[model samples]
Target: MTPPRDVAVVAYARTDHQGPAEGLSEAETLLPVLHEVLDRAGLAPGEADFTCSGSSDYLAGRPFSFTLTLDAVGAWPPIAESHVEMDGAWALYEAWVKILTGRADTALVYAHGKPSAGDPRDVLTRTLDPYYLAPLWPEPASLAALQARALADAGHTAGPDPAADPLAGPPAVADGAAAVVLAAGDAARRMCGRPAWIRGADHRVEPHALGLRDLTDSPSTRLAAERAGAFRAPVDTAELHVPFAAQDVVLRRALRLDDTVTVNPSGAAAGPLMVAGLIRLGEAAARIHRGASDRALAHATSGPCLQHNLVAVLEGDA
Candidate 1:
């Protein structure tokens, strides 16, 4: 792919992100961030050429969770829009493709989920293969634990313990929401003085059966990273979606990011949910926007044991 002529993230916003999200409705949880992005870009909702979002009805304990969010955008006179049951990162990808096809020049992308509303583990099982995998009741943590063990057996440690080996235990989960605005060419230049140009973006999926694949390496992520042209440019910072601390090492190695690249400075203890990976991309873009870094890499993951992955490279003007 020649890559889009020019598509950059002009604005980004996120929620306070507490577990369970308490009494806030989905629309309430998302509206503020959506407005924040528009405000940052100095654009109105109606100005967006297209709008798309990602959310799961299963998370809200009701179907059509996104339908209500359309009200928050006040989609009067209707608009070009779409939804995904996946994370906002994928929604961003979908919107990016829309621009590439010459269908829209700008897009608003957002995503939200309340993992606290239900047993996130139980709900996550629905992502597995319905006939074969869902029946086994394999929650995400247990599956991630298995991957952690594989890393340990291969001499990878989650902590400093030479023998303690971290992935031998369970992984952690967090909840949150994220939003970003994308504009093309002249629109991008008009929105922000320092737009974070999306140099490349790609996503890939692995087979559903964990037992049938190699646990040590995430080929899906590796391929996506390569397709995103991460190797073609040097990265000064990398925000990886590593729910399990050790997966950070896995992704860094996969993308060949090393000491020269600063990994997540946001603190390892704070992991956000569905939006976490996507937020990594937004954070990387922010660094470029602020002149804090010249080039950066962002990654997002899905499925049990990191079976699905997406990667994008962001670069600022030289």
Candidate 2:
């Protein structure tokens, strides 16, 4: 079998995070970021062999929400395009595979969402089992709190129970957009001074039924990290897409990250619905690009109670 092709993140860009933009369209917010990431990679529109995006129609209240986002990419020439109804990290995964398969040398991955446009908890419910879970309309944080409680019960709780404060203030809400450029082999080295080569990337999910999963643990994350080779070595930095404080604890144990690893200097505040995950990838890759970290981990999670998890291990030239 051929050895896996080396894929690296060459450039990353994201908009300033903030509370709801009074009336900004998603396309308006993403256009500049699209141009900037491509420019950083020294590419023009449609220059990449493939382009993919991650987003959701539920957040936009319109079917085919991703098509409008295409306006930001200028698909006039009809590039090899695709989209995922997921966070941008998943979109990056698609592009990574495209390069690894030798079908493309370079690809652009982007994602945007305006969770501020509506009540996010209400929207996130759609990710649950519609037949049984969606009807409950349980907030994602509430599910996380259950995990917090379970951790405390299982003696896995590292510190104060994050669930103890149900009356605590809600999480910070922000609209966000992000883009990343990926290249394979020599192209990656040329596009970046210290390219963050993807040593391993994998995502896994547990059973959809809430009762079928162990709320106190993230086996899927652990398995994904194992498959992604996260435990093969220590990472100097970790950018985690933590939806709740308790989820952070769950992720730490799964990734086996110790204090030596710096976590989320880029701020993991959940910006919009799908953008935060991609931002995690961009943040980790940026650190490697700048020589700030020789090795790093970028994690993204979706679904209720960490039902789905993605792990990517990155390292700079040795």
Candidate 3:
């Protein structure tokens, strides 16, 4: 297969992520971050060739919630834009593809969530199958606990190993938003002194039926990493979207991360729901841009029990 074009993350900005940021509307929370990333890249609002975002209406409690947040981007110019209901990592995927296609030299990606406004776990139930799982109305905690028990029964040890039990970790909640800028080749080198070039990126999904899945293993995650070329080279750092301890174990195993690779230095487990994945990607890119790591891996997950997974490999100019 042909290799994908090289696209780099030029800049990224995110909100401080208060436990449950009070008094700040979703747009209010994102506006400054929107401006900050562009300013960091020395680009004006609506200056990018394309713009995309990831968020959820279910969390926002209204239809077209994503449209409301466009006010932060100053949509007056009617720029090329798009939105995804999934985590911002997916939105970043869209923007990356656009730049790779040669249709755009630069792009902007962002994702936000006010999950603290409501029961975030309960909100997640909506992603379940309505014919079966939805009726049970099981919260994420219950599902994860079940998965953890399954892992333990299967004799999987939890730790830096891939089979760690996510349910073993403490529960946490946070509210925040994040944005990233993308540029291709020359545009990328010009925007950022040392761009974090996207070496590979891909995502995969598994059967939604929890009964059909081996809760102890994440085949989908491994598949995505393989397709994204994550194992083709050694990674110095990894920013995985591990909300629980087991997930950390599962993803590390799935991606074949060894002891030499650093994992989750930003404490992504405590970040907001819809935005954490993008933050992981952004953080990994930042480390590469700063010469902290020559190669990095970023992973994102969606759906219950890690049903869906995305992986991106980044490398420095060297």
Candidate 4:
């Protein structure tokens, strides 16, 4: 079944993350963004019908880490809230589902990451399969390099730059956070003069075994695009979560993006880990909200070598 209520992104805010952001607490990093998005939509804490977030306790190197971030949102008076271990984009998806279920008319979604706190590559290895991959302790960049090699062997390349090799890019550790506000129908129209309607949204995942899947292609992304109806209408722009240069080739082919679309104008070179993917979705919606495009595609990925993917199609009023 389709969404019960029309949903749109009314406001978005993200930290200016160039690279590593040291000497800042997670709450400090998130507070400004949370306030910015809410203020843009003229909202206050507990104003949104629901609140959700995405982050990794493992990245924080502690258990129940998200609870600490409640300080940033002023979680007193007890508001309905939820969180995901994945990218904030997934939190947004959950919020969208909540709206469709008629459980809420407005929602707040956000995500944050501080990868520079430790060896990011080694930290990421903790998510891999313990039996086969974790024991080997392969760096995240090494796995991307493997994917890049697979693509090259199949005659696919993202750019002529020598850094197109995944290893050349390495795992860029950045620290930051981002947030977005979602409203439904009238609530949306009232909050923002013109909302970025979520025309379609879906996510998919592939087998966990890196060796079992064809690294050159992202079947999960292709399936997500199909499920999200990404091709139903012409796309004017796309914001892709391409941390490493090589993954761009796989995403382009998987989504069938052409030169007609403006890809990642925000440069998306690097950002805080879990936050980057969600920021891509926010950036795409912002483009539509600002009248930069009639329709746009936002993509996010998780797991090693794009094992999981999320696709979103946003459209502005004609």
Predictions in order: lDDT: 0.80, 0.86, 0.86, 0.87
Consecutive 10-residue window with the lowest summed lDDT within model 2:
159-168
Clashing pairs in 3: 162-249, 164-246, 165-246, 166-245, 166-246
| Cα lDDT tens digits for candidate 2, 1-111 | 122998999999999967776678899989999989998999999899999999989888889988997888988988999999999999999999989899999999999
Clashing pairs in 2: none
Considering every candidate listed, which one attains the maximal TM-score? 4
Candidate 1 per-residue lDDT, tens place, 192-298, comes to 98999998999998888877888878888889988999888688988888766556657777888777988875545234556776688788888889998889888
Q: Which residue pairs clash in candidate 4? A: none
- Candidate order, lDDT descending: 4, 2, 3, 1
Residue lDDT tens for model 3, 78-99:
9999999999999999888888
Off by over 4 Å in 1: 158-175, 268-272
Give the number of colliding residue pairs in candidate 2.
Answer: 0
Model 2 root mean square deviation, Cα atoms? 2.0
Which residue pairs in model 1 clash with each other? none
Which runs of model 3 end up more than 4 angstroms from their true locations?
1-3, 160-170
> Which of the two candidates, 1 or 2, achieves a greater TM-score against the reference?
2
Error of 3 at 9 (Å): 0.2
